[model samples]
Target: MEKTTKHPKQSFTVMNELVLPNDTNTLNNLMGGRLLHWMDIAAAISAQKHSNRIVVTASVDNVSFKQAIKLGDVITIEALVTRAFNTSMEVRLDVWAENIPSGTRHKSNEAFYTFVALDENGKTVPIPEIVPETAEEQELYDGALRRRQLRLVLGGKMQAKDANELRAIFYKD
Candidate 1:
């Protein structure tokens, strides 16, 4: 039996971390690797919640480090399942850095992570579809297909000729 669709809010996850002395580099800024690890965890949690099964990270979109997060800053990671395909889900993450001393927060950047759901036997399984509830959710939901097609084309899993959504971007009738 097919499962019912879920709203994106049902899978939203938020994570917070503090940058300590050990988490900083020579310039007193948080290390990129550490931030990536936190993002991965947040994204994985979101995927798991949406799928209700174990998930493995299949790919991560290009991440741009917009601003350097200084030490002693508070980092907040917000994650949500934008869309779920047959056996994989795309999780969108937004990272923010906050300086408590100055009460300033910056919208760092956003990235996408793809995860495939697996059953007890480690075999891929279908995931529940997502129904966007708000305008923002709907936009993300609609754009997810194009992003997926782009990823497949770039990953060599799908030929450019078969990427209809992606082709529509460059070529219009």
Candidate 2:
């Protein structure tokens, strides 16, 4: 059977949520854990869209909270599948905090999440390939492999020498 494919835009997901007092921390800003929860939900939606199967988060890459989202702020999270590798895929999420009074939005954070599709029996299942339309999408797609390799190496799943793209970063002359 021919493998299916989907465009990055086809998996694009945007989610917006209001930050309530319950979602705030002692400083009255949105809690980091709460934001991460929202990001995970948004990323899972994008992953499922691209794979058309049940997906679970495998890992979440560096998440730096650049700005504090205050209570009553609207947090908008945008996610897209950057690439798919067999059963696993990478989803990039962008978060923005919007102030209702000022009607302004600022980038709060960004991160990459990895998800794996599963069959009904919970076994890993192959997913469709991803097609990139724009230059930015293509760049991300091309770099996904390198990122995956690095993650595998860091997690002790793969040896450093086996990480081709990651090895090139340090061994390049």
Candidate 3:
């Protein structure tokens, strides 16, 4: 049995990986693709925990590689579901790189991943709603819709005119 609603913290997930030679490039920095893969897994786990059902990657928002993670650094990925719609949930991921030997840590970046819950036959299934408990959680919960709308517009799944939240911010009419 699954609950009808869940708090964002309930689905918090943390994953760590050591950047090995295979995960880095000639510059000795962790490959962007490898970091993306790790983020996807962490976010999927978080979304699945929130929905209590299998989830598929619906979309990944813009991910900017602000800082480079070097080889041998421990990469910690933290993920949690910020909001849940009818059958989809928005997961926020925070990536950090830590050099344990040097005792230094740096933030890589943050990204949003959307996941849709699926049933046994691979059909979309309704998921639990999200209840934001903190002010920060509430802010993320509020922004998720705008971000989702932007994604839909860019993907051609939705029209620009239909994005009311975006319009409110940009048009202001």
| 38-82: candidate 3 lDDT, tens digit per residue | 999999888988888999999999898999999999999988799
| Candidate with the larger TM-score of 1 and 2 | 1
C-alpha lDDT score of every prediction, in listed order: 0.89, 0.90, 0.89
* Weakest lDDT window of 10 consecutive positions for candidate 1: 1-10
| lDDT for position 26 in model 1 | 100
Off by over 4 Å in 3: 1-10
- Estimate, for each residue in 48-119, the C-alpha lDDT of model 1 and write its tens digit: 889999999999998989999999999999988999999999999999999999999998868999999999
Clashes of each: 0, 0, 0
Q: TM-score, each model?
A: 0.94, 0.93, 0.93
